[model samples]
Target: MVELTVREALRDAMAEEMRADGDVFLMGEEVAEYQGAYKVSQGLLEEFSPRRVIDTPITEAGFAGIGVGAAMAGLRPIVEFMTFNFAMQAIDQIVNSAAKTSYMSGGLVNVPIVFRGPNGAASRVAAQHSQCYASW
Candidate 1:
């Protein structure tokens, strides 16, 4: 058995999937040049280039919505939120759009998108940043 950190596992999963499927891509802040905020996407941009591994601006809502739209268009997108707290800014796109699109479209559209990142508490983060919205 091999052991890997959460970050490594995430990177490996995306890498493997992208290799298997040409339609798989990733987009998020720090996902490219910075190797992800938590380093989960380390080396992906170098390997896949700007087209497959995108690095977006700090506009979470805009990029998150774009990812949802891309997924609806038959591409598999992996949208990363630096932290779950930041996800609140794009909740509508995630909850009402991406999550419900497949059902609303009667299965005609498959939103094969993964929205992920470090959820829950951060060791030194403050109240606004450390809370876990999943429990609520």
Candidate 2:
């Protein structure tokens, strides 16, 4: 039997998808230069180049929108939110742009995207950091 940490499994999935499809790419704060805020993106930049693994500012809504737009353009985008709680800032985009782009566009646009979040704050934290990733 083989066992893998959540981070490992997520990384493997993203890596495989990127390798299989040139249209698949990952982008988020600290994903490239910082190797992901949680280290889930540790070796992606080195393995796939900066073009496929991108780094952005700490603007969740902005990046989420960009990811959704890219997905609408026929590209698969993986977006990481430092914490799921903060994802609220971009929830509108996820629900409207990423999830319903095709329906809203009368099936002309399909948003193929993966959204990952709630990282580095699962214990004794407060406020938005108090999110539960029970089965993440």
Candidate 3:
């Protein structure tokens, strides 16, 4: 058995999925060139190329919406946030758009996407620098 950190496990799962499906791709801030904000996307850009491993500006709503749209188009997208606190910027796209698309379309439109990020607060961080939204 192999012991893997959460980040390593997440990266491996994504690599496996990408290897298994041509439609699977990953996108997020620093996910490509910077190796992810938390280094969770370490070597994906090299393995999948820029076309599949994409980087986005800090506009969470913009990128998350793009991911949702891609999923609606039958592609599997992995959308990573530097942290879930920033995800609030894209809550509309996540809850109203992606989460509702299938039901709103009567199961005709399915959004196959993954939203990943570290949750909760880091120890010893400033109050404004940490947030926990697990209850929500």
Q: TM-score: which candidate is best?
A: 3
Cα-based RMSD of candidate 1: 1.2
Error of 3 at 40 (Å): 0.4
Between candidates 1 and 2, name the one with more favorable lDDT.
1
Least well predicted 10-residue stretch by lDDT in candidate 1: 127-136
lDDT of 3 by residue, 26-97 (tens): 999899999998899999999999999999999999999999999999999999998888899999999999
Candidate 3 lDDT for residue 112: 98
Model 2 residue 50 lDDT?
A: 89
Query: Each candidate: what lDDT?
Result: 0.89, 0.85, 0.93
* Cα lDDT for residue 83, candidate 2: 74
Q: For residue 15, give model 1's deviation from the true position in Å.
A: 0.7
In model 3, state the lDDT of residue 89: 95
Residue by residue across 1-136, what tens digits does model 1's lDDT show? 9999988998999999999999999999889999998899999988899999998888889999999999888999999888878888999999999999889989898788888878777788787677787766
The C-alpha stretches of model 3 lying farther than 4 A from their native spots are 123-128
RMSD list, candidates in order: 1.2, 2.4, 1.2
Considering lDDT, where higher is better, how would the candidates rank from best to worst? 3, 1, 2
